[model samples]
Target: MSMSTLLAIMGLLLSAIPAATFLRNLPLFLFQPCKANHAGNVKVSVLIPARNEEESITECVESVLKSRNVEIEVVVLDDHSADATADRVAEIAASDSRVRCVNGKPLPENWNGKQYACYQLAAEAGFHWLLFLDADVRLSDTAVSNLVQRMQRTNVALLSSFPHQETGTILEKLLIPLMHYVLLGFLPFARMRMSKSPAYAAGCGQLFLTKKGDYKSAGTHEAIRSSRHDGLKLPRIYRKANLATDVIDGSDLARCRMYRSGGEVIRGLLKNATEGIASPVLIVPFSMLFIGANVVPIVALVLAIIAKSTLGIVVATAAVFVSLLPRVMAARSLKQPWIGVVLHSLSIVIFIAIQWIALAQQLIGRRTAWRGRVS
Candidate 1:
């Protein structure tokens, strides 16, 4: 309303530029999938933890086997899938020994399903390196070799990659990029690998590559067996163990569509959003900030224009554009649709709401399901 407040708003808007620049390196892979290639002979135990991914398991297994040059022993954990997921993996495994389907043991007391399943898989695996992949992920031909080479180049114990999403539905298009953008802002790629902070470690669940020993030394899930978000925990654990770790933008090397429909997308996000956010106290503040940053700017600009507050209108418009630009760039880089940026940028509202919903669920002692397992 006044000159001082308008100037203050402008200053806050301008401050985002430096954050954008610092976070600019996050979209590490613009044309990443095309860059995949086999490095050398490195045996990798490609592990998949499938619960009820029957629809996607067939293609996922096929994609893993289609790799060009790399020794791979694919282990798909049938984590008590009630659906035809186990049958599907069995059928694939029956045809090829390279792709073996292993039944995940029941969730033992005090252990999370994924962690227990992974622990079993690791115990059964006889390989030099381990690669943990989600059942929805479809890999490129040279994905393994490329990851190994990147692993070798970085001299790190763990090399994680953020795969691109294959946005088929409207829901997938809107929400998935929000996941990555928050990850980008919350923990910038350059800073995570460069610094040794465990809080900053981020790995895509779709792709987690690490030396077998490094995995074991980090106590694997034994350290955070209770964690619902391994992607958030593993890299940090590895870093704390004095093992070098790095993450790459794998938009090209791997692709996945996490949920089938909008309702499913909302539930999928709610399952972990509250647990995944920084803290309980930050919940409301973050939600309000999210809404204010995205929706307020546009509404404020319109109101300012009607009220004839020239500086207010100009500042609001500039803030909205500046806030949305990097995320638009992120969506484009991730191969999400052009118009998806609008939803992706506006997603901060949905993001905060889902998180609160998740927190409410957790408090009620209700377990969330993903791929048919309690998350």
Candidate 2:
């Protein structure tokens, strides 16, 4: 094959993978309902680890308190925040008997701040099922009850939900939608459900729900105490120990604004970008796949236009469209901005840059710092 033909073939394969996977997972993303019958007897400890979430702490607590048809206790861990996170939790606790705040212990050596906070919360929790949520996450009135019901029916020891991401700023819109894109486009949820391999394990730390016994047996947050991406790591740890873990679409039940501005988005992603990959050996090829799958097709389309080759144009255009199928579906399902679907190429470019920056930081022995804490 000629050089252009070889490049076109490679682009087609890259595009085909995401297109096929997206189609395979679209049904689950669209129609797999979170309609499990209420499990009234299941008491869930809604654990919140707040470092400096004063702005959203009250809302987060109140939302959990509003949960219906399930027994729940709201426990907020104040992780030595400079803000009034603890005070807000305390205010809620005073008004509601079920809501309480616990002062987080001093960060021990070799432990991440969030993990330590989670560990303390789990210790104080007086229930069998533990629901770890970020202070920014806001749940619907039926979220807790519905989640419990799903857990009971699935019988998975550890379950997580990908909440609806609320993005405001332009940068947030461009980047946040990629979360679902990477998830549904790459992972075969059917296989992940049946497989016991750690390779297929995935979860979201923003909303992790699991039984106390399984968590303790899998070492809880302590197993991944120092790891940056607990969402990615914790599920693998459970799978490694032969425990069940899986994720579901919780967008209808909860939503969160994870990052406020461009800088926050970059820093937040930097902390866990490298950790998302299993090993350093996979980084190069993983990066290549991202570039090949999303970036190369756009380039090929331009080249075909310049070369005035009709067949090249047709192939390149189809490849580009195929690559975009997942992002378009995700944007609609997740309720992201329509403009983001139009600008998917730009998002891919920025994502690739973030991954490289994280890899570079890892290589140069630089740690990611967040909320006055470095990891």
C-alpha lDDT score of every prediction, in listed order: 0.74, 0.85
Count of backbone clashes for each model? 1, 0
Query: Which clashing pairs does model 2 show?
Result: none
- Measured over all alpha carbons after superposition, the RMSD of each candidate to the real structure, in angstroms, is 2.7, 1.6
**TM agreement with the true structure for every prediction:** 0.91, 0.96
Expressed as tens digits, the lDDT of each residue in 327-375 for candidate 2 is: 7777676677877878888888898788888888889888789999885
Off by over 4 Å in 1: 3-23, 27-36, 371-375
Report the CA-based lDDT of candidate 2 relative to the real structure: 0.85
Q: Report the C-alpha lDDT of model 1 over 1-375, residue by residue, as the tens digit.
A: 665336437534643643375356554533343354667778989888887788999999999999877899999888888799988888988889898888887788777788778888887787888988888888988888888887887789888887777766776676777766666655566666677777777776668898888898988878878777777788889878877777777776888777778878887777656556734877876665556556566666666777778788678767777667657667556666766667644566667767877888778877677656574
For model 1, state the Cα shift of residue 257 in Å: 0.9
Q: Which ten-residue region of model 1 has the weakest summed lDDT?
A: 27-36
Give RMSD (Å) of candidate 2 vs. truth.
1.6
